[model samples]
Target chain A: MTTSPPLLPLQLSDVVFEAGGKRLIKDLNCRFEAGPPSVIIGPNGAGKSLFLKLCHGMLAPMQGQVTWNDPDAVSARLNQAMVFQRPVMLRRSVSANIHYPLKLRKVGKAERVRRTEEALALAGLGRLRDHPARVLSFGEQQKLAVARAWALKPQVLFLDEPTASLDPAATHAVEELIRAIHAQGAKIIMTTHDLSQAKRIADEILFLFRGRLLERAPAAQFFEQPQNDLAQAFVKGELLWWKLGKANRKRRD
Target chain B: MDDFGDAIRAALNLLVSLDADLMEIVGLSLYVSLVAIFFACLIGLPLGAAIALFKFPGRKLFAVILNALMGLPPVVVGLIVYLLLSRSGPFGVFGLLYTPTAMIIAQVILVTPIIAALTRQVIEDLWLEYRDQLLSLGANTTTALPTLLWDGRFSLITAVLAGFGRASAEVGAVMIVGGNIDHVTRVMTTAIALEVSKGDLALALGLGIILLSLSVSVNGAVYAIKDAAQRRHA
Candidate 1:
């Protein structure tokens, strides 16, 4: 994989995203600098995926900008890649799927072949090189999706619940790939609902709730001593509203 | 019953003997329709792909107009082309009237809409699935158009074949624009009309059988291509 210049310090300033007459993300101000993998954890409908898309420049914030230092969205996008929750496979062989983005970028034939082979081997999919991507098992397809993105050697990789549908074994494999990608100097920003997965891989944790950033802290500190009520309840595996209700009732009594 | 039997026998004899006149009509039919389809695809595929991929001010209106043109009466198209190519008309200086060129123009007018509209439909559906992934992979709409078109090729083949079927079967447009000129603009559909009018039922039946076979063969080829594409993907 060819090395790409680092695209870091993604800054979101007062970003607001609204759709269908509803505000999905509201006045979010955050800056993510170069670091280990940043895992976003929240309940379903908490806008974790939307936040990732907003930061990746796939969705424009209605009010503010998501700037990745120096380069604009289009130029920065060339050095960034995203893997959606449900990975989409092209109607072609796994090797061809890995080669597509490189071809689009006008990579030379020899370089494309070398990168494809290296990526396939990295993902442990060298044996399935000729297999049609759509025919692969769910786990294998997700792995191929990562391999396809990894071949690009993106500077910033955004993953939105990449293993949401995978079995535990598949999840472990995908997690390992994510770590490998991080080890190779790409900043990994991922979102997941799985608390344990976040605990396992997150260098820093960004906790979101109801489209708001409730807390952002180091993973160890956030897990050991969350600074917010919602984060505390979330860590205890208790429903936010239920915990709030009990606290209110005790205060009334 | 006797007429039917005699017509069948005549048709069989024409087929067995490889009648020169019959061969000429069939050949002209294939030539005109294939040329018409070729031009139609050249104009329509890109038009449809543009319509599917771009967001323009009047895109929906343009799509609706193309959809309505899909059912345009062939005679109406013939009349329009006939006027344009007539000596007093705007394009009369080209002197294409009463020629195979005019017939091809008429067929193109009739078939282009069908191909464009169906291509638009097929490509639009494909773009929906591919838009995000392609865009995420650093492709803009223009870069994505060719990929979408190529991936949706199997279904696009069916659309072009539909246009060919309409071109080959319709006689009203060609008869008017082509003047049914013997040995010049004469084709299967126009020849069938002339033979039936002259009470040459056997010759008409022979042309009819050939036309029917042509339609069936086109349909068969569409299914074969579709099946092959599906199997390769599967």
Candidate 2:
């Protein structure tokens, strides 16, 4: 029961999200097949994190539906996990933190021990097995969070700004863990403002601007020649205000 | 002042010699309060956790009511229980009035709200931190309650101890309900009250010392548990 049912080919159709009477995600339609990580790149307030949360079932779209293999949200969620920007560590030992999800799933005692040890080894936290998770350094806590999620062996893993606040070394470590998790056959849907990080890990890029899905392209194609103006500005590190003004003009026209 | 010194000396002597009457009162106090707290926790912990974690109409009002009940006067509680257990009342068939059971019922009524209110505050704060994570892990509110309670066990210990403290120290409730029946319903608080009124300062002072020691010990146990949890999780 540790592994979830097939959660591949996650689809979002006509997804509309509004908060505080403002649209945050507008008519989002996308199909994410099982494959290399799909990196979402957008500027601040572009609803990147919200989109991730919506797709991960943390937030329900005000209209439309998000389905995984046509299953209900709860069934879909059983096989998925999300890592946040600042992951919360339970007030327990590192091993206990990793063991929690397995216990929740009612995995047997033997399997829990095995998966816990495996996850700790994968995250290189074996030495800190008995240490309290809260006392870990920020980087180590993030790693532990990933390991805890990884132990569940989710089919689709959503990361919202997983490395947003980490130093270079810590960022590299977390990125490597993300890659490792992906290599283990989980669909990685990650949101990052860092274009270079997106470039390095994304098999495909989903570009968003002002709550709209602007473009979805192969990683190489997106980096070489972005089709949308906002994508181009984002790729070239230009201010998005100019592109926003152009979009406003186009809308008005 | 000389009389106070004599009382202290007698208190110490009574404690050292393990006086039977004093011991009986101490034992009865512990039994009644512990039984009350056991029942209180059984009702309060889950009630508090549910109130904190769930949403429904009038939840705010329910929470306000529980918080207000935390300050309910013990004598008022005693009065209410007395009415219920008296021979003419609805539950009078059980003949529970002026008995140890009546004393326990009064204490339970007095302590349950304290445990529930404090547990709600502690568990509510924890739920804020844990709600998203637990829900994301496929746990609904019901499944997550025990996890939240277990993780917050150290603070919950303090809540239970608080209930015990309230139950043990209160004289009005047990006195009204138990009638301070000699060798039967007599407990430390009621005994102290009786001895003090009868001008028997020696027994009163002795019982007072035992009650104070019990309070100190309960608090010490709470602090010890808290420190251990901190060290384990810090």
Q: What are the per-model DockQ values?
A: 0.57, 0.61
Candidate 2 lDDT over B1-234, as tens digits, reads 766777778788888999998888888889999999999999999999999999989999999999999999988988889999999989999999988889999999999999999999999999988877888776789888998988888889889988998999999989998999999999999988999999988768766877898899878987987998787787
Give per-residue lDDT, candidate 1, residue A212: 94
lDDT of 1 by residue, B99-194 (tens): 889999999999999999999999899988887788888788888888888778888988998899999999999999999998999998988899
Candidate 1: which pairs clash? none
- On the 0 to 100 scale, the lDDT of residue A178 in model 1 is 91
Per-model interface RMSD values are: 1.3, 1.3
Give candidate 1's TM-score.
Answer: 0.92
Per-residue lDDT of model 1, residues A204-247, tens digit only: 99999889999999999999998877787788888665377358
Candidate 1 residue spans exceeding 4 A from truth: A1-5, A239-253, B1-7, B86-95
